[model samples]
Target: MSGGDGQPRDGSGADQPQPGRSEAEESRRGAAYGFTAYAVWGLFPLYFAALKPAGAWEILSHRILWTLLLCLVVLGLRRDLVWLRDLARRPRLAGGVTAAALLIGVNWVVYVAAVLNDHTTEAALGYFLNPIVTVALGVLVLRERLRPLQWVAVAIGALAGVYLSVAAGSVPVIALTLAFSFGGYGLVKKKVGVSLTAMQSLSAETLVLGPIAVVMLAVLTVRGDTTFTTDGAWHMTLLVLAGVATATPLLLFAAAARRVPLVTIGLLQFITPVLQLLCGVLLLHEHMSTARWTGFAIVWLALVVLTVDTLRHRTGLARARAAELADITP
Candidate 1:
């Protein structure tokens, strides 16, 4: 039943252990999870595009409000209100979630504005630069030492971003705002020790935004400026998809984060923005001037360097792990 490699030998001479089979199944699940996350992120431009007619501010308010409602429904269905109760018990954790909530709200608003104002490419650039920002944050906040090559990569990436900002006339305020807000969200998320589910975290974050959303919606309605009435059913559908569009990738990301190695997650994060860039160029037919293209090329090269450095680090860590295990055996 078993082979030298602990794989079970089938009647057709194929080796497959039950444990290996289980592992293979889990790997499949993890790939599906990761794929779903990246795919949703990749196609987000289409969803956001449909909501462009509604105006960014109104769409942003709806996103915040509807996401909150949807999350509440999810919590009710799962009967997981305990996370909210837990947060209530610890006001500090609630405060952190509230801060995170504000950060992501700003992120959503900026992203919507970028998409609406023909700056989809800029939004893509912001995301392309996010990994580097995260790495820079790790260096500053966590005091993790980066390899020499990584530092160089960060410098190059930053310089490319600055070049693009300068070339675009004004500083790329939208890009920097998007990156810093989302980066801060990531940092805050790292601090919370509470065992909140992904839905719970989203719920808490949106709950923090709910009152503001209500006020915004009421103000818009009273001013005879609600976009929903004139935006038609098709547009409304797109607005609602904001909830699904926002939540699905996050859910898949949560599952993938639990299953995959951190190195793999780090590698996969590039796919989203890469797809956004392609969508902006091909589908949206956005133009990048020669200098802007040059800046993009520089950023791409920096990312390649950073990625190689990361792989080297991961390999080194893996080797160190193997050596530690071997030492324990003898």
Candidate 2:
């Protein structure tokens, strides 16, 4: 959900404060946004599952195209048309965003396919693995330090991955792909700093990818290989609604990213995979073998450790801040 500081990962600098808001209030708002975003993301199995008759490619294209249209409208409303101009001035930044777009786009296609292909359990596992992946990225790539319990959580996560692969008699490719792609996406976005807000960044990513989405949709239509050509109005409506599905959670995520610490966002991400596991097991009727359950239990235990550590840290920090304020009082 966010880097530890909830600030831009780009290493550029601090955000200029909005005059009216207190930092405490902003963090509260951020936590709310982060929770909402993850909750919506957790329910995405229903969204992708409903896109029957359209393959993942078709669904992804519709999502991109519609999301692009929606972003354009929103940007227009905000009068934020300067993305292109700003990118033009910074070719390296454009390249970075393009790379990020591809990672996320690939992640999207794979996830949609997983949902429709009855690999929702794998998909859910993938997201559960993602925060651990993100934390690992922080340590390895950014040279960040981890608390002892945080390191223990990461180590346990590694064991979970190994157990799932060994017990399942196959590598958990879907879960690994999802975790790595999204983890890498977060890493790159942070590295790029806050040159662009989340909306602007997504707008630019879709813009870069939009032409290809158009061509792909057009080709599929011409070849009679697309849902739009064969499906009824309801299907088409759902397809177009992919834009709404895509945009809303992302917008909320952007809002949250600005307001919360990355670790806080990370902890809240549990909402998503937990919901997804429910959808996969209870709703989709996927079998949950004892071994699979064991694997999940290990991961869940790791999350419990991580969550407890994070909560304690925050509580201690809050008490310290309160004492500081008290000392300053008349």
lDDT winner among the candidates? 2
Instruction: Give the Cα lDDT of each candidate.
Output: 0.72, 0.80
Find the 10 residues in a row with the least total lDDT in model 1. Answer: 1-10
Local accuracy of candidate 2 as per-residue lDDT tens digits, 8-70 = 232111233355999998888778877877778888888788888689889889888998898
What TM-score would each prediction reach against the true structure?
A: 0.89, 0.87
Candidate 2 worst ten-residue window by lDDT: 3-12
lDDT for position 318 in model 1: 95
Give me the displacement of residue 113 in model 1, in angstroms.
0.7
What TM-score does structure 2 among the candidates reach? 0.87
